[model samples]
Every structure is written in C-alpha cells, then in structure tokens.
Target: MPLVTSRRFFELGDTVWARWYSARKETWELGTIKEKVGSKMYKIFIIKYEATCIRHIDQLLKFTGNDNSLKINNTDNVESRNFQSLPLLPSMPVNAPLSEPSVSNLRSSTIVEQPVNTDAIDHGNGEEWGDYSAQDSVGDSTKIPEASDSPEASENGVEQP
Candidate 1:
C-alpha cells in the first residue's frame, strides 16, 4: 500500500502544480523523483517537474504513516559558537596630536604690514610731465591756435591783400 500512498502523494503534487498552472494559465511536465531526509525521523520525496517544458522541479512530501518522530537538525548553534569565540580587536585612538605646524601659525609670523608711502617719491624721468601736459593740451581746446578767417594772409608779408 506504500506505492498507493506514494501515488497519492504524487497526485497531491500534481494538484499543487495544477493549482499553480491554472492560476498562471501555463503547461507543466513532471521530471525525476528524488527522496530527501528531512531532520532525523521523516523522509520526504521531492519530485522534479517542468513548467512550459523548461525542465523545472517541485517538492511534495509529508510525514509517512502519521508519525511525528521527525527532528530537524539545527545548524545555527555552530554559527553562534563561532561568533562567541571570535576575538574583537580594539579600535585605535583618534585624538593623536599633529606633528606639523598648522597653516594659521605658519602664516602668522611671515605676514608683516607693508609701510604706506606718505611722501611723494620722484620718478626722475621728465617724460612723465610731458605726457601729462600733452593730455592736458588735448583735453583743453583753448590752448590750441585757431585758423585765421582770411585764407590768403601770410605771416612773412609776401602774399597779396
């Protein structure tokens, strides 16, 4: 009767696939059957199935003969033990003093107040005043001589009246 139960289990697996297939509206095919030992007391059969002929798998397994003697092997204890034995390194102190001089202190001694020029300093070149006088003559038109109204008038007295 184990084969009948296994067949019923396979049918249950088909029901699960049918539910999913109908929900998604797609075709699925069955693949290899493998048994997995879950915990210490229960043996599970994982059936490989395909969806849309893509070679997929599904698992459908429960306790055999209604016996609840199955125990799940706990692997979390090993991780917890390793974590407990791990050495926590101390963090380095961040308040160490700097060995180099700061920008403010380095620039403080080098900054000297430049003396302001209160007395007029002579440049010793007379061309400076010549340029200034030229600029003044150009700016004031009264300094320029006006052209005489009589075009024939001569300064040396050699022209006609």
Candidate 2:
C-alpha cells in the first residue's frame, strides 16, 4: 500500500516532494513541500519547474530512497511518526564506522615565501583599482537612474522644466 492520504499530516520543515499542476503550463511538475497549509494542501517550492502552486496532500508523495513515494489518502489527521527526519546527507559521513583520518601520521613541509601578488598589476589608465580613494579611482561606473520627481513621468522626449 502507498503512504499517501488526505489524512497525511506534515509538520513544518518536513521535507516532501509533490506534483504541482499549472494552468498556464498544462503540465505537472515535481516540487518540495516547504509548508503545510490547511488539512489537505501544501505550499511547494519547485525549482526549475515552469510553475509552482499549492498542492493537495494526495498530490504529495514521500521521498523514498529512490526519490519517490506513493500518495494514497486524504483527511485532516494526526502527524506522522513513521517519517523521522534524518540529516540531509553530510558532505563527509560523521557516523560512518571508518576511523577519522589521522593527521599525526602524515608529513608536512613549512611553506616559507614572499607574498606573491597573482592579481593583475595595474599599469594605470585608472582601470585596475585597489586600495584607492573614490577620488583616485577612475572607470565607467554603472549608473542607475533615479525615479523622476515629476508627478507625470514621460517615456518620450518631452522635456519638463
């Protein structure tokens, strides 16, 4: 039997992958459940999907080891204890049985050298700027135009005094 139902209860931070339907898209997309809304619906954040929207509990499935689960039922109900959050996989396995790498057994060499500036050396022309005051720096800076003060703004060449 699949583990999906309207009665399925998801708590905050409970991670779930669900199918989302889009009217404009005419397609269903997979998304993660970020919030549980009401009894049977959820707010899903779908990355790379054309559209994301509120989905029913039935539309949501458990993210099993293979990355999918079966949705089965629907009802307002108690939270599920079957699903306990395991830490999202660690970059390095802390709990794995392997012994930690021993640095004491490793060899090292002391690095002694003058500081090298790999960065481009400024030949001047005010292009390569570093550790300089605003007055000392020179370049074509991006300028963001501020909002016009006039109550009526013009898109065309209408000059206002």
Candidate 3:
C-alpha cells in the first residue's frame, strides 16, 4: 500500500476548514463540505453562518487542528503546512439546519479600509476636526443645504441678474 499524497480528503457532511475567497483576497473560514459538485469543485456552506460558496480541490487545504500535531481526523493533518490558525466550530453540527437572518434582523453595517487623515485639526474650543470613520461615525448632516440647481442662482443660491 502506497502513502496517499493528496493535500486534502473531504466528503459531504464533513466539517472542514476550507479556504474562501472574497473579492480578490483569501480567507480560511470554517465551513462544511455540503456536496462534491464534480471531480474537483465543492459546494461549501460558510459557518460565518451566512452565504454558500464553491471552491476547487487545490483551494481546499487540509485543516491541521492544533500545534500538538493531534488532528481531528486522519485526512486533516496530511497537508504540507500547519494550519493551527484555522477556526472551527466542532460543537456545531455539520448538517445543522440553517436559518438565514433577514436584513432587518442584521445590525447596521458599514465598509471600512478607507484612507484616514492623520492630520487632525484642533479648533481649541474643545473640538477636533478629522475624517469620520464608519465605526465612530460623525453625526448626520446638521442641516440640509438649500437647492441651487436653477441656472439663474447666484453664489449664495440667491437669484442673480
């Protein structure tokens, strides 16, 4: 009998940590192997407990559970690299019924990673002016600006000759 060299060996209902790509980058998230779509493609249900996604065999790295070299299963630690950082929800069932959260059930969301201005202005009147982030969002627009769409409007939105 020859030693198996496959980087990973997973099946349906197996709770494995698969690599999921969002946008262009990669994220090693906790997921369940829902179905083997083909010879290589696999449909995975993300345990972020949200959307379902698909990945290829090469993309599915083996989940090496701990640094002690004690793996959860035989095929888990057969990979080259040690993936001790891979998160898992062992107590959670791989085939557990999913309940998709509605939009209203979700909390307020915002996108980050935008450029932040390092130069913050201090007005000295107990006020600091700087770029507002989604987390510590500045208050909403204090007052709505009067419409200045009319062609005859002047600099101050006043009618001009």
Candidate 4:
C-alpha cells in the first residue's frame, strides 16, 4: 500500500508542537511543519527529535512501541493518537504575561552623560556674553553721575563728553 501522510498536533505542557514524519523510519523527531493558509504565509516550528543515530532510532521505536513494518501500516494513526495525548499533559501557568517582556526593571538602567562645564566660557574681551551678566550693560551705567553735566577732567586717554 502507498504511504500516507497526515497532520498531527502534540501538546508539550501548555505549548503545542506539530509535525509530520514517517513511523517506518523507526524513529521520528519533532520536525518543522509549514501550512499554506493564503498567498503569503510564514511560521516556524522546531524539531525536538532526530533518528539518524542508532541510539535515537532505538529510543523512537521504544516511544512509539512499534517496529518498522508495523509503523508503515499505522504511521498516520499513531501520529493522530500522539496529537490527542498533548492536551492531557499538565501545563503550568505562565507567570508573566506574553505582552510584557518581563524586563520592565531594565528600562531605567541607562546611564546619562552630562556636560561637566555647562557655564559659558569668557572670551576675555572685557565683555561678558550670554544671558544675565554684569558686563552686558553699556554707556557708562557703572559710573556715578559727576557733580556737573559738563565734561570732567579727561582721564586714562578717554575723551570727555
């Protein structure tokens, strides 16, 4: 008889693992399964078992309780039974919500770099720049009014006016 292939679902705790493999191979591992839903489809599944080695082959036969000849006859049915047994397995509750990545405490762990000398530098032209400084005022604001409005004695080579 021609070999038949079918879809099978297995439950590993709370998660579901699906695969399609021939039992005749004497061992089967969880291999990836791809389904075409529409024009564009994408999904990833992990294979949890491999039977290329003699040890693995023995292990697989032990798990399925079937030899190569028997496997060829009931490969599809065996897979179906394996799928149904998944839900019966006890699944632990997920402590953290899937939407939350469980790393909220790490969000504020970044280091901030601050400029050490934030104050403006003085160019030393006797004029102070930037907001709020004593040197910013001009036109004799620093000198007291002389006794007379007329020009006083010229000092320091400054022209009196």
What's the lDDT for all of these models?
0.29, 0.48, 0.58, 0.32
User: Which 10-residue window in model 2 sums to the lowest lDDT?
Assistant: 92-101
Model 3 agreement with the true structure over 102-122: per-residue lDDT tens digits: 456446658788785566654
Reference-based TM-score of each model: 0.13, 0.30, 0.36, 0.15
lDDT of 4 by residue, 66-120 (tens): 2222222223433322422222224432111112123433344578998865456
Per-residue lDDT over 33-148 for candidate 2, one digit per residue giving the tens place of the 0 to 100 score: 67777778788765434345788775555544333342223431213212322223454221211232245655668998988664545656655545554454543574445455
Backbone atom clashes (below 3 Å) for every candidate: 2, 9, 0, 1
Candidate 1 on 1-161: residue-level lDDT in tens? Answer: 44543233332222121111332233221122233233221122222223222112222222222112222234322222211221222552222111323345433246779996544333675334433654564685555543442454556454542
RMSD of each predicted structure: 31.4, 20.5, 18.7, 21.9
Candidate No. with top lDDT = 3
| Model 3 C-alpha lDDT versus the unseen true structure | 0.58
Better of 3 and 4 by TM-score: 3
Q: Model 2 Cα displacement at 45 (Å)? A: 0.7
Model 2 stretches astray by more than 4 angstroms:
1-7, 22-28, 66-161
Return the candidate ranking by TM-score, descending. 3, 2, 4, 1
Instruction: Determine the C-alpha RMSD for candidate 3 after optimal superposition of all C-alphas.
Output: 18.7
Better of 1 and 3 by lDDT: 3
> Which regions of candidate 3 fall more than 4 Å away from where they truly are?
1-8, 66-161
Question: Candidate 3, residue 47: CA error in Å?
Answer: 0.3
Clashes of 1: 2
lDDT of 2 at 144: 42
